[model samples]
Target: MDAMTSKGKPSPRSSVRPLSNEQVARLGERHNLVDVTRYYPNGPRMPDAPEIGAQNPRATARLLEGVSIVMRQRSRVKAWGYDRVPTNGPFIVACTHVAMYDVFIPMMSIFHQGRRPRFMAKAEMATWPLIGRWFQLVGMQPVERGSGKALAIESESIRILASGRPLTLWPEGTLTRDPQKWPMSLKPGVGIIALEASRRLGREVPLHCSATWGAASINQWWPWPRRNVVSCFDDRLPYGDLLKDMGAWGDEPPKELVDELVRRVHLRLVALLAEIRGEEPPAEGYWDFRTMTRKPWPQDFDWRIGSSALATETPTDGVIGESGVDPGLNMVDKGAQS
Candidate 1:
């Protein structure tokens, strides 16, 4: 199934075969030949002028400038499909978390393209030394996990969308613990916020899935020859079908529908990352954050039930302690929301 044509259905397991040795070598050659100066002179231009947000102008300018300088000295960043990103109004950006630094790739790309999006990030970031205040100044919505305020956090995210501003989030919540670094099972909060906000606004919120690769190859300590970093802003994922029956379900969306939405997002990210790396993802399955192991696509998994199961059955399953609260419910980290 084409990754971009998911009409509110789960994407089929990938059937694309791995690239051949010669093909892989050719891909590498193309990246190595890229001229950073050509693309680095200015950020990718958007077809429509960017819709500015409520961020502090000076702070946003300085933050973008500082990030651009550091990225230029470290790696060459190239992006595609800027035209696919919506030029105006409220939308959601669900990006893959390959590395901590990869967040800047999308942030800079979007800022340069002409829209300033408010990003969801861990609340602790707001308490950091100097940069903490800077983060809050430049559209960082703090996500306080395990606080029993899952509904409040979701409400805040929906409010941002309702206000007609773009919101970016990393659904995985944390740096991928996936052994191979591919995106893993995503927290369900992204699905919840999107579906809820769309219902409230009387329209389906445009959701875009982005993937970045090659950051893992960089060594932060001793940087020599810069590596090639590439990002793909995929066509807006179609999710209008999910809202067709919204009037029937009162108040909150059903858990099953939310799970399905999360599944589609995960599958799209996998396909996009696969294209970037020119390699096939593991056929076995995606890494489950709670389990810390590879497993096939969950067919009957319920986010709330899964969290409760982990709490009672396997106390030592994953990072979060025995709270048993679903990460989807509370721990959904909007990674590096700048």
Candidate 2:
């Protein structure tokens, strides 16, 4: 609870920076922008441009407003877990990307915990009119996702961590289309980052993996939406001297060592899912003919089945739903504590 307030102050640090929801919304509506990014000031600059990104006062507020809109218009999501997040220090955060709004849980949680979450986004997202400018202003480093660009990302991550700012990343690369896909797989980019940070900083950066359950699914929208909950789990991967104890070079090898660290994170997430449901495992592949129109699975687990690709072809939009006016994600409904 003793997190330094210096990091918690809203970006832009001025009331006149035009980072408000109303202003951003008006700009987005008129410009047809769906996403925005802000880059934080890397060095001193004029007061007019002042700072961007992390300093972009309106980014978080506007995003929160948008999230609230989705909650009201779409399904409900009962959220939980600000108590578990840390208030300070530079750590590497790994979260399971289950939905598009997954980014918000960490961001909002940190907001409540009095810390700002710094995340990495794709470089191309910078091209979006209003959205890109926001990200560029927020001090978020852009990484090209793929093998060829891996070094660039690894190097940037090392620098970010060295600067003593915690980094939050969705190690899964992409959202699992089916949460039932238990620990199916993940890319090792996270490992690469950890390896580099350890070698450069002479310390193991704390790595925490998180998961969210019942976050409003694909069709969930704004105004009065369905409830969603996010439960997070954390563990540490000692990088500093742990690497020497295990005898590894740089951060990339022994592949087995890195694999185990990654797997442990996955296992922690799997346990969280099982614990939340009080079940053996998710019915991820539990496709049903009745749900031929969608990726079917009930809110409460029952109709048992396993590992079967649906024989029936369902249209993607079959389950598409319109959101009502619920201000969805905006309400941090710390429903019954899990």
Among these predictions, the greatest TM-score belongs to: 1
* lDDT against the true structure, each candidate: 0.67, 0.46
lDDT (tens digit, per residue) of candidate 2 on 1-338:
01101111111212212123343333334333211111111111111111113345466456544555554344333333333344345677777655556665555444433335568766676787876776665556775665466667667777888776768786665554332433334456677677657556665566666655444333332323334343443334333334665334743556765665665555555554444333565444331212222242434323222111121122232211111223232322222100
Q: What's the TM-score of each model vs. the native?
A: 0.75, 0.58
**Runs off by more than 4 Å, candidate 1:** 1-53, 298-338
lDDT value for candidate 2? 0.46
Off by over 4 Å in 2: 1-54, 57-81, 177-183, 216-218, 221-225, 233-241, 246-253, 282-338
Worst 10 residues of 2 by lDDT: 1-10
Reference-based lDDT, residue 184, model 1? 80
Model 1: how far is 163 from its true place, Å?
A: 0.6
- lDDT, candidate 2, residue 176? 49
Per-residue lDDT over 243-295 for candidate 1, one digit per residue giving the tens place of the 0 to 100 score: 88888878898888898788878887877787677766776788877667799
